[model samples]
Target chain A: MPTRTPMEVSIAVAKAVQQADVDVIAAYPITPQTHIVEHLSELVANGELQAHFMNVESEHSAISAMVGAAAAGASTFTATSSQGLALMHEILFIAASLRLPIVMVVANRALSGPISIWNDHSDIMAERDIGWIQVFCETGQEAYDAILHAFRVVRDPNVVLPMVVNIDGFNLTHVIEPIYLFEQEELGDYLPEHRQSLKLDIDHPITMGPVGIPEVYTEAKKQVEDALINSKQVILAAWQEFGRRFGRAYAPIETYRVEDAQILLMTMGVISRTAMGAVDRLRDAGKPVGLIRCRLWRPFPLPEFREAVRQASIIAVIDRHISLGAHSGPVGQEVRSALYTLPNRPQVFDFVLGLGGRDVTVHDFLEIVELAEQYATQGPPESEYTLIGLREV
Target chain B: MAEKVEKRAIIGWRNLALGCAILEPGSSMHLLTGTWRLQRPVVDPEKCNQCGLCHIYCPDLAMTKTAAGTYEPDLNYCKGCGICAEECPKDAITLVEEKE
Candidate 1:
């Protein structure tokens, strides 16, 4: 809303980062993510944001710089896209293990052998288990808002871990929408201004990053699990607080009109907007269909997901990334895994819809709903993974 | 008769030296003399497996050898960080706690 330009969404987030009073940032420019940190760098250079914005040599070093900065007890941030995020893979795990609570924005883009600089969820899918709360946004507004939510989530005592906000590289990151620029004072109330809980103290010089022996190794991993498990609650609390302060609502798994619906459609990232439109059409035509838009991915919201789709006869998931030779697509696989143990679990199916920035119109989503209807009457298996929109090339 | 209370203290090892299990005086004093005590690793040929893992992993070549090729821990100058013992695959050299 600041300016009509789609790039302003990223700028809004930059302002939020400025307002958040980040102490350090290490960024390397790549498409879709370039404008974000570019504005961030300008903010730092213009004396608007008093922070060390280190322009690193590689994305690897960019994350490495933030890691070192965060470990030394500074609120750190970085933004990157497909190849850049891929390059920072090894250091990503290190950032989480060190409990740095760094925030990053991944302009959700497809990975390459063909080298397409387009939007998809592949890049994030590659690093899902690197121990970060991954949030996907459907609009530029959500993208900006999720940045604040990410900071709150990562910095919370229950979840002292790094977080990534995946905005659709071309769709959400490059789309203009009315995003309310949050006031710093309001943000202070919603998102607490607690600095690092613990950091490098020279008086008590303890060796951080020490090699863990077998005796302490499992305990170290167990601590991370406990913190991450508690993150689900912290994530919801962050969203609720965001809603309270800003009058904008969010959920880990946001359901659209599923109270008495028989069939449900599932989606994530920017595609959920298109899917929601399709669900509205289906509902008007007397099809008992609804939408489940997963706003949060990591520390996957299992209980909420089961409750959202409990009464629904079928749950058709639209995945933007393909996990080749696997059970199904990434989001599709996880959705099933979450609901499989339930006594009255819905018959879940996969619809591997879009990739490399494929345009998934509302009609494509309608096709998914229709397919779910057919499978519902036929009494489908425990679950099935069926890609909806791929003609064998 | 009151039980005689002896005001004496003795520190000793709980494990015996079996085969090549040498628990030389005391080792693993990382908290105390890590910066002061120096003990380079020495390997007894009768027990070593010539694993070469220790040679490769030693950050400081404090884990070196004598002229005849049996590994000797140079204690006079070694920082006694015990990185060598931590890396030794064969577990041949037991660090004698060089008193600080």
Candidate 2:
């Protein structure tokens, strides 16, 4: 049995990579995500983990190097956040389209205009359509386990796609929590040696990423889209196998006390923990309320999400990022679209909050629930989304 | 005919992503680019000294040595770049307008 140790999530992530025994790590230091690659560098330096740790100049070079490493048949990994992730935007698509099974941990942070290094989903949300398997972690333990699972999921032959595991910046990344650390032997049983049949080898001499002219561009895109959409099965299989092996189960949409509830609060990342507290208070006060934490953000888990909120009449979606000028927040828009065709769908109220590391307390969640209830009865407010907890000058 | 071959190339694969990738290096040789030429280079055998200067300077690798030890330009793959004609010391190659 693996021993439970209290440590920072960043350390746990590095330890998971160590256990997986990745072949290459190309990373540049970025705030919140720095500790993960720093610890990884230490592990490599100490000879505890046998991997090539390339300290690159920038995040773009880091990701570009990983693309080359992955193409060369190496199990590659990297970590970045915020501006770093933005810098790697162009290469992110190429990595996915080439079907490189590289795993990345993105410490989700707000994109800067005012230059705030804080926790939010804007960073990863801006990259939602980059064609990688994206998963969000709500706790330190999830962050640890998800990294291991990401390797297994991405390396699956049926789903040869890159994966991004999003951990809220400074919230889960810097927090210390008790997590079960897996033994290297046990990890060997779960994740085997990565052997890609199609790779850049001198003996085979293959050319990857060729020009797709007008006659072939659509088919190439369809191939990538189909691979991403079809990867959901492999994702679920990996989670199930992990549960059976490690005794901790995970789901795409994890619900908390949703049975017979009239109103549900949907959230992602660490805010879901706070929302659970609000649900407890609302439940104790004789109000039937529930919470649903969205774990898998990409390949968007449509069927599971629709079923999770099917019984609720009103759903308050707490978005940590704003999709300016859109009808609602990113998650809100996705949820509404998923449930649009249902005969008796719930009314979704978009509440944008906690941008730039603003605190979202139980009181705020309670207010959001009340406002959502009002919107349900009053047929929505004038605006598509309401910005909560904003101070008026 | 090149368009037909390109269409066949696009549809002949089971997996488009893997198929779109050129698994064999230098496979672009299979793609006939000769039709891209508006003017073709004609070798002047009478004026040609077997110096192989045009063969050495052909950008497309279209010029080849024949069994008689004379250099000839393979028009099937040549793009009519006129580099060989311009570089031939013996004036052994000339570019003529290709007509339908």
Candidate 3:
């Protein structure tokens, strides 16, 4: 039996990584993401977790160290935030292309301009094409569970790619919630030992990440692309098994009150909980409003998403990050593309809100639904994407 | 490694190994980069003096120290960068343009 304990989400994430029995953890301290590695360092020092906790100088070296450790047949882990994640941009592609299953947790935060240490999806949105398996978490329990699931999925023989479990920086990482902690013994056959077949060994020499000249570069890239695309089934299977063992099921696209609904609000990360509340209030007021929370960000989960919003007349995609000149937010852009070929597709109205830790109340969600409905009937808005609550100076 | 096959016969993306990692050890020896060389290093054993500087300075590990205290350059693997010729005190090694 697992013990339910109230703990900060970051510490719970660290505990989950500890429970995964990671061999190497390389990280640089950054706001919101620091507590996770800080706790892991303490655990290692107190003999609670037996692992090499390296306090690297920068996020670039942190990820680089993880790459070396992972390729050398170690279950490696790391965590970072906005600027740290940006610094790791160059090696991020290298980690994915080299097929190293180095699991990471990104405390999603806003990018620097005015320099804010607040929460948003801007950090990870910049890394949309990094080729790693990326997932968003709604709560502390989900973030904890995701860390465990990430190690299992990435280390799988077929899907030996790196993974990132994104928990909204201050929103999710700094919050305290009741998370059920599991014992390593009870994990039993669920997460088996990570044995990388093609690892660097002195006895058995094998060259990894060798130069792929023009003759082989395309093929090598195609392999990574195919691997990510093919990992959908593997991801689903892992989720199903996790549900069967833990009794809490997770899906790529989680829907709320979508039955016979005309308006659907789509969201990701912790804000989905607030969206659900708005959905409930709207339902109580005799409105046909529904909510869709996208748990799986990368690999898109296009078929599942289409099925989720097929019945709705309008989809108001709420994004924490704006794509600047692209007019629509990143999620909104993807939703439009995914629904482009569908028959009688729903109209997608993108709303970029809650940037730099700006508060988004349920009232804001209600307003968004109204705006989306208005746009649906009155053609499109002046701007394809509406920046909600921007005070006009 | 498996009988120098034609480039056209290279395996497709589906058949390529994971991450395109070379699973076979010492597989690079089959590439024979010596074909890329424009000049070849020639050693005059008479002035060689058994200094072994060529063996130390050769970037490609192409120079072998003979049992008779002289160094010989293996033209099959050497790219003829002339590093060995430049470093040799006796100047016994010289870079000559390859004929065909």
Candidate 1 Cα lDDT to native: 0.76
Sort every candidate by lDDT, greatest first.
Answer: 3, 2, 1
Q: Record all residue pairs in model 2 with backbone atoms less than 3 Å apart, i.e. clashing.
A: none
Better of 2 and 3 by lDDT: 3
Show where candidate 2 strays beyond 4 Å: A1-3, B1-8, B17-19, B32-100
Number of residue pairs clashing in candidate 3, backbone atoms closer than 3 angstroms, sequence gap of 3 or more or interchain: 0
Lowest-sum lDDT 10-residue window in model 3 chain A: A183-192
Off by over 4 Å in 3: A1-3, B1-4, B26-100
Give model 3's docking category.
medium
lDDT of 2 by residue, B1-100 (tens): 5566555455532456452577755656656668679888888778888898877888788999888777887876899999988988888788899899
The 10 consecutive residues of candidate 1 chain A with the worst lDDT sum are: A204-213
DockQ of 3: 0.59
Give the TM-score comparing model 1 with the true structure, all chains together: 0.79
Per residue, candidate 1 scores C-alpha lDDT tens digits across B6-98 of 111112221211111122322222222223665545566777766666666665554566566666654433676677677776677676665
DockQ of each two-chain model: 0.05, 0.38, 0.59
* Tens-digit per-residue lDDT, B8-98, candidate 3: 3356898777878888766666555666788888888899888787887788889998778788877668988999989999989888998
RMSD of each: 9.8, 3.2, 4.3
Interface RMSD of the candidates, in order: 15.2, 2.4, 0.9
Model 2 residue B94 lDDT? 85
Residue lDDT tens for model 2, A143-179: 9999989998888888888999999999999999999
Question: Which sequence of candidate numbers ranks them by DockQ, best first?
Answer: 3, 2, 1
DockQ for model 2?
Answer: 0.38
